[model samples]
Target: MNAVSAALDDKAIATGPAGPLLGDADFQYLRAFVLEHCGIALGDHKHQLVQGRLLRRLRALGLSSFTGYCELLRRDPHSELGELASAISTNVTSFFREMHHYDLLVDELLPRWLHEKRREGDRLRIWSAGCSTGEEPYALAMVLAEAIEQSGSKVDARILATDLSPQALETARRGEYSLERLAGISAERCRRWMLRGEGEYEGLACVHPRLRELVTIEPLNLLHPWPMSGPFDAIFCRNVVIYFDQPTKQRLFRRYAELLPVGGYLFLGHSESLHGVNDQFELIGRTVHRKIAE
Candidate 1:
């Protein structure tokens, strides 16, 4: 690799120390803070992750240490807490992530749903729950746009991409992506949905304006009253439920069930499920479930 490239990579990864922050008490404080503020039931495994993600932010803010920062978060009750939550929130997503789901949506699932929805004013709605940095929803929008054009179907599709992280939402709104993040994108998909960066934007890809207009990025804590009314057709809530305790997951899934219609689809992360928490949804596939409207 070039010397300049290696240096930039170093800077990116140099955001924190290589291990958990000092003190078990400090670790416990953050665990409590995350649970109290964001409703994410963190445990011993995430100690290093929380410390790593927060080290740069805390240092940048000139907080004396993790102890002081935790104190600030404890006392403050405003957007700052949300900002801290966002900083520590997990976001390991990419374009067309977990290809099977997207393929199913495109090849078999969406066609049927679109056929049905076309009668009801040609509208379709999708929610990308816990959408980090916008890739998943944007990627979905691009696929839907392509599907619409290909099928010559005048379907009005909208995707609500929500995250508790404003910082991630800001990045989502900007829609500029580093080359590394673009790896998962297929060449054809890239050509269609992305504008390759050049000049000042070298080694980056920007979501085309046409596609950008399709997704509405919003700062949303799932714990909030859901501010959205839906008989949504499908909800892509991958990789988030594992963070919550059983009761919280049950409540959240119940809320999701209420928001969606009978036969509505719910997608979870590969490692997550509604097995113990929710019985209202019928598990149809491996990690995919259909909300059984009771």
Candidate 2:
């Protein structure tokens, strides 16, 4: 056999799974590699997750193996640099995914914020970091609108919703959702905040035009420097950071601390916690953290 063919054979041996579950050594190697490059780390349980998410990309790239793909990332730099992040990053979100956070925002945070600002401002700023499919931000706008109307207050509010997935951002910008995803949204909120489509658009409800106007969707990679200037009053960053390593999470929290002001709020996913890594935030509940007045 020629040298090239021999090299290919050797590469295959390294790339293919090394064990029953996953090649644990290779998994550790890949995790370390990814963390160095992107600040994301894969752990013990994510073996299947890495395989399932990156396997298709491997096929698409005509790369026969994960080892080869890792080589590409290491050497080319641009050779599908973002593809793996796209694969592994969790994008699951819905309109009001965890409803109580919205309740707390409307009932607790916004009211107090408004009172503190008093004649100084009518605008409220929010960053929906890791905003997936736009539903969360749209739902936020709906809730804020209701709160403003009920308070007999005219509040100018805008939400900066960013996500790494272009596809996800497009879905969010469309503001069109299937009926099944509307489960958490109440019928009353629906009538007031949605336009029920007819004919070919049947069974899909589009967000109200006014609500759509409230959110600005942007494509962003959280691993990179953020494209925002803030002193935002609140940030809804949920269900995305669980994939990162402890150090990365701590670094992200420091950044979060900078973006939000004293007494600002940070909402995390139900499964996430600020317990061990950072001391900057006070845990209010399971997923709610308050940026202490600083």
Question: Which is the leading candidate under lDDT?
Answer: 1
Positional deviation of 48 in candidate 2, in angstroms?
3.9
| Candidate 2: C-alpha RMSD after superposition | 4.2
Where model 1 places Cα greater than 4 Å from the true spot, the runs are: 1-26, 44-49
- TM-score to true structure, per model: 0.86, 0.83
Candidate 1 per-residue C-alpha lDDT over 84-201 given as tens digits, one digit per residue, 9 for 90 to 100: 7776666788888888888888887777877766663677899999998999998898878877776766677889999887778889999999988988888887887789889999
Candidate with the greatest TM-score versus the true structure: 1
Judge candidate 2 against the unseen true structure and give its global Cα lDDT, from 0 to 1: 0.77
**Pairs that collide, model 2:** none
Q: Candidate 2 at 259: error in angstroms?
A: 1.4
Please give, for residues 1-294, the per-residue lDDT of candidate 2 as tens digits: 322223455534544453222356657877887787567877678888887777787667666555666667666754465566667776777778888898888778777766655463567898998887888899888977776666665566788998876668778889999988888898898888888889999999899988877799997767778868787888888987887888888888889899987767789999898889777788887688888845
